[model samples]
Target: MAEGALFEFLCRMGDNTLVLGHRVSEWCGHAPVLEEDIALANTALDLIGQTQMWLGLAGEVEGKGRSADDLAMLRDAWDFRNVLLAEQPNGDFGQTMMRQFLFDAWHVEMLAALTRSSDARIAAIAAKAVKEAAYHVERSGDTVIGLGDGTTESHRRMQAALDLLWPYVGEMFLPDAVDAAMAEAGVAPDPASLRPAFDARIGAVMAAATLTIPEDDFAHKGGKSGFRHSEHLGHMLTEMQWLQRAYPGASW
Candidate 1:
């Protein structure tokens, strides 16, 4: 039971990175500038690489024949455990940056805490991942601050994006049974325990950007439970899993 719970927790972490990486990858050719285009792609690659590590570890823990590729390429949207925030549509540049910033802030905090996990595999992965996540926080936070405090139009759009994405943020800190088990085992940090630091980091960014943090505590959940997901995830899977679905066992 403990192993199963750890596997699930790892998958949830991988799914979050995989789904969000795919979302960010969508900007590869469409970013507003060449520098940003490269930046987003680099960030996407970092996230996808992290997903590989976490999901690979999960497959090992499950003692199943499934490889990381099998898990990532074969899962249906309902089986994915990524948060809704990661699956949200990148409505605009501002929205994308806001979403990225929000996730990055929490991600860095989570990874830092996970580096001390009793599970050596998880700890090693988190230790390496926290470095990339710190850079991600810096990149996204800078973008948010720049755009949020920029011209009138930019500022308005940044605020709007924050408001739109805030509700989803609460889900990041909400602890469920799986989290409780992992935390108890010292395999994972308690989600609630990470919230204070997350809040402090994100609040500092928003304050610097002159943007208002949403006041509501209401959160939408379901993704971590592997039972619900945004409509965007289905479409995303169509593209991400197409090659594997179309050509079983085929590889480059």
Candidate 2:
């Protein structure tokens, strides 16, 4: 954490929600059931709402006069700070829910810790957000459990999803300089510090679902650091930012 550590940390928070919200929104009308479609849509809306608050604060902290929309739509892939997991493709309904459950587990813990952040604004935002996050985790956990313990086909797909997702889980808990500074300042917990709780939460759900965690703990990195990004994210940004980039400043 150096001169712009807070700005960097804020971007990481905002970018996670912004990117994941877009990913979740992709399920709007394509969900397997009408109930699921509506639920996913609402979940996407909640994530995007959280994005506005996080990015709004990021923009303010940066003092470069960029708005949330600018940070989200104006920047290219390498500028993003979301974990690699958030940008991963939605393979199937089962995969989608699996991704949601994993992230939701970490999210609930992260937001709960933020509720007591030394920064009042951060604490306030987390206080409001923790409520939505709680529901998100519970719903996702139930879905994971249901599909994991369901019929053979359902269980097979869920197990596959869990394997694909588990590797990415490590990145969320990997601490960096920004995290150290945030923790030191009492603004946020070190990402690593959240891992034990995340592990316990997921372990129980996985056991109920009867899914196995992958053997190798190989974690991908660089997305949050802006050093590198997966090919998927560049493509995602092309669509998400197209409207903003094509017609700069166009708005209702």
Candidate 3:
């Protein structure tokens, strides 16, 4: 496969974790319970750790001499290749877990596929990330069930979250040129192939949660393409990139 294609694929992987990690980090100290606060913090840390490996490899593949931090903290929104799902705002605690559950379901499958990547580095990174992702899906699924099947208000909010976030889920399985290259090279599975497993996983969890997925079949696109992004990304970039932008060469 072309090196450019590999770099694009890596960016997609790294950017997913990076953006979602930041969103989850926002829950620190704001979760409804102390345990959840800690859990969210750890989840964010796990994702950021995976970000280091993924973007680190991405930078190496690009051979631009950019570090992972540069790719993560210096890039503009239009340059990011994360799916639109990962960038959605964490509306409420229920919404946050719903988003996490949805993404985690997709993520677990993605990482599992990557662990078998033809590229050794990709395989290694996925092996480590898949472990954390397993836990992420489990915890998020439980939270989804707890909130979705709990009190009437919790159930209502959880259902609302599912309705709002479901459209974003389709983007995870949407294939683009970059995804095609990755799959053809055996560096990743065809994005579409992962859909069946992802569906089965989420279906069981949502059933347990008693949450009905939206039947819209309509998905928001553009984030992975880097041709378009939601307004939320630009705003997020301002805060996420500010420190690095303010101090160009500074580092810890």
Model 3 agreement with the true structure over 82-158: per-residue lDDT tens digits: 99989999999999999999999999999998999999999999999999999999999999999888999999999
lDDT of each: 0.92, 0.92, 0.93
Q: Which residue runs of candidate 2 sit more than 4 Å off their true CA positions?
A: 1-3
Give each prediction's root-mean-square deviation over alpha carbons. Answer: 0.9, 0.9, 0.8
lDDT of candidate 1 at residue 122, scale 0 to 100: 91
lDDT of 3 at 157: 97
Q: Which stretches of candidate 1 lie over 4 Å from their true place?
A: none
Question: What ranking of all candidate models by lDDT puts the best one first?
Answer: 3, 2, 1
C-alpha displacement of 127 in model 1, angstroms?
Answer: 0.7
Clashing pairs in 2: none
Model 3 lDDT, residue 21, Cα: 98
lDDT per residue as tens, model 1, 65-122: 8899999999898878889899998899999999999999889989998999998989
> What's the residue-level lDDT of 240 in candidate 2?
92
